[model samples]
Structures are given as structure tokens and as C-alpha cells.
Target: MSTTISRLLVANRGEIAARIIRTCRTLGIETVAVYSDADRDAAFVQLADVSVAIGGEAPADSYLRSDVIVAAATQAGADAVHPGYGFLSENAEFAQSVIDAGLVFVGPRPQTIAAMGSKIEAKRLMADAGVPVLPSAELDGLDDAAVQAAIDGVGYPAMIKASAGGGGRGMRIVSDPSDVLEAVAGARREADAAFGDGTLFAERYVAPSRYVEVQIFGDHDGNVVHFHERECSLQRRHQKVIEEAPSPSLDPTTRTALHEAAVRAGSALGYVNAGTVEFLLAPAVGAGSPEFFFLEVNTRLQVEHPVTEAILGVDLVALQLAVASGGALPDQAAIGAPRGHAIEARLYAEDPAAGFRPSIGELRSFAIGGPAHAAVRVDSGLAGGGVVSRHYDPMVAKVIAHAGSRDGAARQLAGALRQATIDGLVTNRALLVRTLQHPEFLDGRADSAFFERNDPAALGAPLVDGPDVAWYAAAAALAVQAYRRSTDRHTAGVSSGFRTVPTGPQRIALVDPAGHEHRVSYRF
Candidate 1:
């Protein structure tokens, strides 16, 4: 294959940028990085072969600004641009600009992007391709009168979604007819804020549905293949919190049909590189199998890519680069079915008890490597010394545990999370651990609406007596005090002067995000 580009400019920040850079380096491609003022000292910037400052911290002024990104690429003298998800990854105009500037976009054509970028338009396209989709209503006109007319056609309990937006930023659900206007307005505001497009669409809010998505890869020659499905049913606020490969709910027949549906959807757009075909799966009714419908196509590598990679034993990021360089996808016949079971839990720097709000703080201490009992794999963006910032998504890492069976996978994931420790910035690790242990989840009875109905505090922090993880900090603090006392008496530091902190007869006060403190004493 002839190479059109040797240097690639990554037009995003944080972990995704770092991910792309790693692949580019392995392929002998020089890389350039862009960062904002807030991320001037970011790890990605320092690691890149070349780095450029874009603008201020907020995504709008920096990463999302097309001009800044393109200018950075040009100034960095890169021949290709890779939009590493979240910022400009799915923006058709951004893709067009890269092509117009004579730089390889490392993705699909601009027209293809424009086609699938809209939720309503994409649904229509998929439906034409014989892919089932949920009920939809396009906001043909933005006026109140037109919305009312559209709602009457789509029916009640519909979601108002931003056609060009993602990450659950511009969406609202109206269970009652009276709240349609408020939903439309709020959705538009969020859409405009997030994607600079206020065009909204309506789709039926399917109840008891699971978020099942298939990873897809296509080349310029029109060849397409499915990388199987990942169950992203576990979500919070429409954002996926946990994902697993080879959906346990799908049988062989359903899996084949689902994969075929995803391939057809990808073929419709002439998609290239890696993208995900999100579908909504409704529960079985009466005697029939469950019905699945195309939801939306994520036009970039997903945050949950690790789960897919873990089960398939392939590096998707590397594959993406290969596709961009005009290389053929790994032979469809060469790829086997997913091996074993894989589960992923996103570790977010947020307080689960306080409504799972975003948190920002410097990490004081951290440890993630386990004893290899569960085939644990951690794809993280932070080292122990990094800071969790408010300027980006709160997800710090994705911990995946692979095993021979679903039950083993679940238990292994829980074990990995339990053994993991982070000192600074409250996280949802405990909640994820609890969800892994949740009866409904373990039995595969949970769906996309599971978190919406369950209490947030209950998922990560179960009511059961958890191993006092925080107790270690207090014991260590007290142990240090004891060691100092010994040193004070001896007037010298010695190995014998240190005493291991015991869990017996220790008490400490722990504070919740709400400023409520509880005294937790320990007894050994």
C-alpha cells in the first residue's frame, strides 16, 4: 500500500489522543499533539513527537474549535489528522476541512459523515437498508407548531435528541405530552452548546431495552466486517458505565442477525476504520424472542474499545491506522469468534453517593496492577500523580476482566476492582463493584434502564459490610504516629521502631460529598 501521509496530527486531547499516538508510533508514523492551556503539561503532550498549544481549557475554545485544530495540524506540518473521539471526531465539517486541506482524514468521507451524523437521518437510512430501528420523528421544522405535529405522529414517551450531538449532552425524554416544548427547548440548548447544531429529533423511548452495539470496520473498497457486539446496557444518564463483549443475552442466531444488521448499517454509510453500531434490544414478550432495533452509529473508536480488544485479542487502534493507510482489514476468515468473556468497568473520578457528580482533584496515591488471577487488563489515562480535571470526561480508566464464563468474568472484574486502590478524588469503583455483584446484573436481567431505576448509592456502595478500604489510610496515619513516638523515645530511626498498623481498636471520621461525616471505628 502506498502511504499518503507519514505524520499525523491528533486533533483531540487526553487518553484518546494518547491511544492514537501509540498506534501511530508503532507504525513508524510521526505524531503531533494539540493541547489547551489547562492541559499544557498533560502527559499526552509531553509524549508526542511534537506538540502545539491550541487554546484555553474549555472544549469549545480549544479542542472543539475547528480552526484551532486545523491550524495546529498545519503548523505542526502533519500530512494527516486523526480526530480521536469526543471533540471533532464525528463533525462532518471538520472531516471536510481536513480533506480540503489535502490531509488524510483517517476516517470516512465527509459526505458519509454528514449522512450518519443525524439520529433521524441515520434512522431513515438504516430503515431503508432493512435495519430495524425505533420509532422516529424528525423535527422537519423547529417551530412549536411543527414539533406538536411531529409528536402526534411519533407518539408519547419520546426522546428529544440532538441530531448532531452525542455523549448524552442534548437529549430529553417526555413521558407526557404537556412537557414536549420544555424538552425541545432544553434539548436544543444543549445541542447548540455541545455540537453547535440545535436540530432536534424525536424517537420512542423504548422501555426495558439494552444498549447492544457492534464494532465495525470497512475499507474504501466497500469491504465490511463486524467485530461482534458489546453489551453497554449498564449506563447512567445515558452514558455507558460498564460494557462487555459478546453480549451474554444473545444466542448464536440473534448474534448472527445482530452482526449482519450492524454490517448492513455500516455498508449504508461506506464507513471506514472503526465505528460502533448501537442498537436497542427490548425484552422478550410472551413466547417470541426479543426484538432489536438500530439505535445510532458512533463514528469513532469508543471508550469501551478495550472490552472488544480484550475478547478478540486484537488491537483495534492499530487496525484503525492500517485501514487509514489503505491496508485491507484483517481477513474476515482469519478472525475468530470472541474468546472467553470480557467485562469493563469505567473508573470515573466522581462521587457516586452524591448523585455521581464530576470531581476534580490531584491524585494522591494509586495502584491498579493485580495478581493476575482474573486476566485483568487496565486501560487508563492517569498515572498516580495526574490530576482529574473538570474540562473533560470524568472517566479515568477502564478495567477489563476476562474469564472462561460470564459468571467468572463478573467475579474476576469485581476482584480486580476490589484490589485496585486510588487515594485522591472520590471514584465510583465501589459502585461498579456492587453492580458486578447485583443479582439482576449477574443474572443478565438488567438493561439500559437498570441504573435509572436503581439507586446510585446502592450500585457501587452496597449495603453489605464491605472490606474497610478507607480504614487502611487511617491505620497508616496512626501507624506513622506510633512510629514517630518510637523514634522520639529512641532519638533514632530503626527498622524495629516501626509497627505495622493493626485494624483492632481504630476509629476514624469519613466525610461524604454532602459534608456529612460518619465515625467509622475498626476492631481487629
Candidate 2:
């Protein structure tokens, strides 16, 4: 049976919600946005055709409450519900709940999500399907001695990860055998808090591996097509900061194999809608073929899908809607070859110099370029006066630049980020700019440990006010003094701080954004 949706309710918030709303508008479908109290005036809430207040600010009280979201969708007369990325986006139970409520869930089947939900199960399934998977062990059934044995079997520098949740939660790297138990415990706690499941697993950690993920789409008929790949090797804290399309590290043969493997993965599960299959590509040595191992499946649209969209010249959201509605995907040949290159930088409210700590405060000023011939495209859920509280992800905007070449794309994006005016809270804008210009990144050799290898201070150095900045401060102070002199009653007709001839030096104190005061001296 074909499922048709007229009005859709987006069961999430922030930029992804806004992103879905934009696509829905293009398709002439009305959108319903659910928001917490914290996002009452958020951009997505304002942009949606209708909006509902779900609950309090915390995710559990609001976004994670599946029943409440379903009720909101029903009340809003939405025929379908789209869980944008994050929150309940990859949740199998939530997807089932929506299906049970007779609303079309705009994503893969609940079974598909369940299959790929756990890292262990997904890897086993992929391995069974002739897909290469990293060696891993399920620790739930293993004793302490057995766990240590398994770790030793997998070798050192293995990763203990929470199989239930992603986003780097409940994850730890165990280099020493003595640290295994503590790492497992910590990962389980974090996993439980983040995903309500504390199931842990261990995987062989491959160093100097490139993180590349293929965007895939499947129809109800079992037809699946791959939408090329994205290079996401540049990351910090296990989260992607910068991503680009058409991995520079992959040759045509490897690229074709990657695409075929991704298609096999999707078809094996009867996958439907949009999903991503991430892989770790070890560089080829001495002209040998590169080795790629299955990482995990993100059973929903990825944050870095825009780069794929840019290169492929297709709207993935549109495809998601079509596939979710029981429509067929275009023929493989019609998808066309990828062209040029695209790069995306996630701008966050954080201080990279201070260990990338989240910065929360009002955005006194926010300015970015709109779409132009060759300009950057900014996707943001924030406005100039928006308050970036600690309630959600600190990402303020996603700036993407498309060009005819990889270097061109990187340069354009970096220039755009450097030109952006973001005030109030400290941001990682300068860090992103520096990363795009870094030689390692430019040469496409950046690995998962890129941040660990580079100096955070150097990355955020551009954000530092240089010595010449004092001149601007002094000039601003002088301008203010001039204005006061022009407005004062006693000094109305006289130029204050001005003598017929030059006199003693005048000292003007200016406060920097970091609250440092600089005294400028000048003789007039």
C-alpha cells in the first residue's frame, strides 16, 4: 500500500527542523513544528505553518516524549511526522509509535532502525552480507576476565562505545588493559544518560583512517541508490567540524567499491528513506587497494548530507519525502555523476582555545552572507538577538560553499567564515577558517586525530585581537569623545581635547570583548 502524506509535523527542533520546513514549503506541504518552552520563539517554530508547545526545555520532558509528539501531530492534523536529525530521529521505538498512530513516519522502517541501532548487531549483519566490518565484541555477556581477553584479542587502542547511542556519548579509548573496566563503566553511564541504554561494545580502533560516509536512499520496492560520499576526516571531540564531498583520498575504483558496498548494506535490510553508512578508509600502501571497514549506519539524514547534495545536484530531502511516500527512486544512471566540490563548516558557540568549551549567551550581532552566484550558503536557526542557552547543541550555523575544485571550495568557505560577524559569545569560526587552510586538511590527509595533533591555540589564533586592533579601539574611543564634546552644553562650540598646538598625550582606555582594558596614548 502506498502511503501518502499531506500535512507533516516535524518532531524536532533547531536548524534541521528549519531545514525540513524549507523543503516542505517547496513541495507545497504544510508543516507543523513542535517546540519546547526554550524554543518558543525559535526560527523553526516561527517558520512552520502551525506549531505546538510540547513541554519544558529538557529533551526528556519535551523532544524525547514520543507520545506527546504523536499527540501533537494528531492534534495538528498532520498526516505524517518527520523526525529531523538528533533527538528521536534515529529512534526505532519512536518510529514505531508514529506508525502505530497511523501517521507516516518519514524515514526507514522501524525494523531497519532496530537492525542498525546496535553497533554489534549491525556489524554482524553487514559481515553476513559480505560487507567488511571491523572486529568487535559484545561485552554484555562477557565476564571481567573474558572482557579483558576480548580486548587483548582486538588489540590495543580499542574503542569501548555505547552501542545504543551515537554522537560520541558513552565512548572511551582504552590503551591500557588496567583501564578497561573503568572505561566500560564510564561509557555505559554516558550511554545510559544519552540513549537510555547502557549496552557497551568494543571495536578495534584504526588510527589514521579517513571517515567517509555514503548517502543512500531506498524505496519500498527494495531499490537502493548511493549518492556518492563525503570526506569527514576532520573532526574534534568525535564530532564533525568540516565536511566535503568526493573524497580526495579515493580513486575511481575505491569510490565505486564504496558505493557498491553502501548499496548492498541498504538492500540487505530492506532499508527505506534516507540513511548513511559510514566507513573507515585506510590509505592504500605501495599501490595496493585501500581497505574500508563498515563503521555504523546513521538511519536518518546526516548533518553532512548537504555536501553530497551540492555535488550530486539533487535535493535529498525531496528524495526522502518521495521514498517515504512510497515513491520510486530515479534510475541509477539518471542520478548523474558528481560534479565539482562542496565544503561545509559547522559554526558553533564555543571557545576552541579553551578546549572547545560551549559558549552560551546572547548573540549581540550575527551576520552571514546569503545565496549568491559563488557565495556561501548559511543554514541557521538563530537570529541576531537569539539567546544561545546551554539547553541545546551550541551549533549556531552551517556555512557551505560550493566551487569547481576542492581547494576553491575550502578557500571560499574559510573566507566566508572569516568575514562573518558573530559577537557576544565566543565561537569556533576562526578555528574553522584555520582548519580549512591547514596544509594537512588541504592535502586530504587529516584523520580522526586531526585535532589532537594540532594546537587548539593555533587554530583559534585568528580570533585573537591582534596588536593593530588597539588602533581601532583607540579610534572608537576618540569618536565617542568627539561625540560627547559635540553634544555637551559647555563644550558645544569648542573641540574638546583639542589645543591650538599639540599638548600632553591623551590616554583612552578601551575594553576588549574578553574584558581586558587597553590604554591608548596619543598627542593632539
Candidate 3:
């Protein structure tokens, strides 16, 4: 019963694939990368010891082709497959296929994935395992009247959710009973389009709630460990934008209870490798403890895993490799108490002012630098010359900072983002910086609806680089011309900066970011 994986094939692309390859190299394991035509020259592919082209650019033709992936692994002689988050990471059939092909999958058992993949089934399982679950009514063969009765029982302000999918794809909030039928129908349609399942369910919508999740790891020995809690309250479009380790608002007692419940959920699934048990905490009433309800379980590594690693000084991917290789669970004492604070902001190639639409263009200049006094870590898949295409997710990079306290961490990250110079593509960098420095976010009072409550217009105003910015740009352009002239044999002795031709005053036409053009005159 050896769990050793000598050669690992990463079944993903982009930054996550690169992240896993880094851990694999550190662990002395040979790594293989699979890519579609669009990602053939991606950073992750270049970093892999061996790479194989799967198919065309689209996910369906490439990344989502489980059979093709297994074949590629076989050809590359990979002993195991590591499915990073997204794509096929949470797909139970893909995991089972890897197993069926006589290769190990670096995630939970297929049965565990299936059990938690569906919201309806996962809720029942959580409730059975003594975990606090939000009340939900199944919509299997229910008539309109029955559905209304169930909604009345759960009260108004209920959410109509698709039991088969997540990421807010098939979710609708029904405040009026008159809108219940339409909401349910809409949720089902969206669910079918996203996950190919139209099954719908109802749950009471909790507002003014905080999103908290516990990271859990388990081995084959039935031993499970919790990595405390992460406050993921800052969200937009039902997706988390900022995540931090060691929630600033949780008390010691509440933190302990959250960990215990997470452990219970993991133990019930007999989980393995890295997984996350998400929870929603209602606002505290008087002096009473905050009420928490199980949300769902992510059966793979999370994008914000770096925050947890920063607080605990642990490489979660390394731990996943060890556990998958039959290593014993990490000792409880060694897990230790989380230290300091960590914050992560996901930078995406999208315009926050325009309803967060994807921005596709070449990254003319992308530079991110931390202050000389702060600690910052940036994980990115694309480089300065890389193109942000319409074929994939709009995420460009993840900026994370660690400090001695929550405010310190938030401030550090905000400063780092503000100092970044990203041109030729609209991005959410400015918005992220504002969010990190906002009063509510700084005071730990920002909840899941922070963006909805706050005005995007005010928060996402364009950055003003001052009147000197244009002068600097002109100077840089002139410097480049001078260098090019010096490199040319015909003009090697000519100093382009000195205006050797003695022409009239030079007029440089420049276009501002708002599409306005202006002319500047200079003499040499």
C-alpha cells in the first residue's frame, strides 16, 4: 500500500499549474505539464520537466478532456495526476478516471467528491454528521403550492439555489412570494447551463453575514486536522476578491468551535489531501455567540491557500504530496497556532467600472513592486508581453502580503497594489487598492455585500498620475529612440537626443487614457 508518486502530471493550466510544479520540484518529484494550443508557451509549460499538448484552446477540447489527459499521462509515464482547482479539479469522474487508469489522483476519493458535489446531498450529509446546516427544501417533483408552503416555512428573503452548481451561477434571492416561481425557474435554467443539472433547492438567505471557511487535511489513517479559519467576507458578484487568514473578528471560543465543526465534516467524508469546509457566520446577537451554518466543501486546493501557508509557514501543496504518498498525518502539536496575519488580493484583467467585464489586450507594461519596508508575494501566470485572451479566466495575478497585524497586512497589500504599474489593459488593481484601504475593510466591518453597499463609482475612480506623468512618458520614449540610434551603424556617432537635424520645435502627439489627444512642443 505505497502512496509514493514518483512522477506527477499536473492536470491544469496557468498560475495554479505553476504553483503545483514548484512544490513538485521541491519534493524531488518529476513533473509533467499538459497544455492546450493557447497555453502551449505558457509559463507553467516551460517550467515542467516534460510537457504534452492536449488539444485546441477551449477547455472542452483540451483541459476538460479527461480521457485525453489520462492518455497523455500514460505517454509521459506519469505515476499520478494532480488536478489543480477549477477545470477538472472538483470533477468526480475525472478523479475516478485517473484512478481507473492506475494512476493516483492528488485529491479526495471519487465517492467523497460525489457526495459533496451536490448541494442537496451535501446538506443532508452535513446535517447527519452533527454539523449546523442551513434549512433547505428539496424541489423534487414538488408542485407550485407545495413549493410555496416550503418557502413560507423558511420565511421570506430566501434564496433559490441550484443544487448542482455553485459560484452563484444558479442562485436567486426571492424576497417576494410572487417572484418565487420565476426565481426558481431562472435558477434551474442557469444551473442546467452551468452544470448540466437543473435541480433546484431553497434556503433562507442570511444577510449581513460573514464568510468564514476552515482548511482541513486528512490522511488514510482517519486523522484530520483543521488549519483554523479564513475571513473571506470581501466579495463581488458572489465571488471572493480578498481573503485573509486568522479572521480579525472571530473570538477564541468561536474560532475553536469552527475548527471542531470543520473536522467533523472532514471526518464524515473520510477526506484526504487538501479540502476546505466553508461556513457563513450570522451577525452576533447581544453577547451570544455567532451562529454558523455549513455552506459546502471545496474538494481541492483554493486560490487563497497562500494566505494560510503564510500564517502557518507550511507548504500545503507539499503536505498534499506527502499525504498522497502515504505519509502520516501532521502531528497536532506541530500544526501550532497561526501567527501574524496575511491578506491576498486577486488582480484580474477586468474593468471594475464597467460591470467587471473582461479586458483583453497585450500587457504592455506590468510591474509590481513592494515597498522596501514590507513583505509581498505575487503569483502570476503571464508576463509583461503576455496576452490576456478571451479564452480563459480574467485573473492576472494574486498579490499577498503578511504583517504582524490585520491592519498592517491590509495596508501593506494596498500599498503594493497602488505601486503596481499595469498598462495597455484595464484591470481591477485600482479597485483592489481602494478596497484594502477602505474604512470598513480596515476596521474588519466589511461583509460579503461590501461592494454592493458601497458605491462602485466612487471606489473605482481612475488613478491620477499627476501632470508629470506625461513628461516622464515622453522622456522614456526619447531615451528609447536615442538607444536605437546609437545601436545603428549609420547613426552610431549621431546623438538623437541632441536634435542633430536642427528641425523646428518637435511636436509630440500623445493620447491620454480617456481617449483624448494633446500635442506637446519641445526644443533641443
Q: What C-alpha lDDT does candidate 3 achieve relative to the native structure?
A: 0.87
lDDT for 449 in candidate 3 is 82
* lDDT (tens digit, per residue) of candidate 3 on 65-161: 9999999999999999999999999999999999999999999999998988988899999999999998879876789889888887888899888
| Candidate 3 positional error at 485, Å | 6.9
Question: What TM-score does each of the candidates earn?
Answer: 0.89, 0.93, 0.94
What local lDDT score does residue 233 receive in model 3, on the 0 to 100 scale?
Answer: 89
Report lDDT per candidate.
Answer: 0.82, 0.87, 0.87
Residue-by-residue lDDT tens digits, candidate 1, 1-524: 44666899999877778788887888788999988898888778877999998888888889889987888888889988989787788889999998788788887778777888888788889999999987788885658888987887788788888988787888998888889888888888899987779888888888778889999999877889988889999888888888998897886778889999999998888888889999988887896778899888888888888888888899887787778879888767777888998999888988878888887878766667567653587665565558887888887887888888889999988877777767667789888888998899899888877887788876656333435645654665565556555767654655432336643455567664446555654453
Predict model 1's lDDT versus the native.
Answer: 0.82
Candidate order, TM-score descending: 3, 2, 1
Clashing pairs in 2: none
Off by over 4 Å in 1: 142-146, 462-476, 479-524
Clashes of 1: 3
Which stretches in model 3 have alpha-carbon errors above 4 Å? 370-374, 465-504, 516-519
lDDT of 1 at 99: 79
Clashing pairs in model 1? Answer: 430-460, 431-460, 504-524
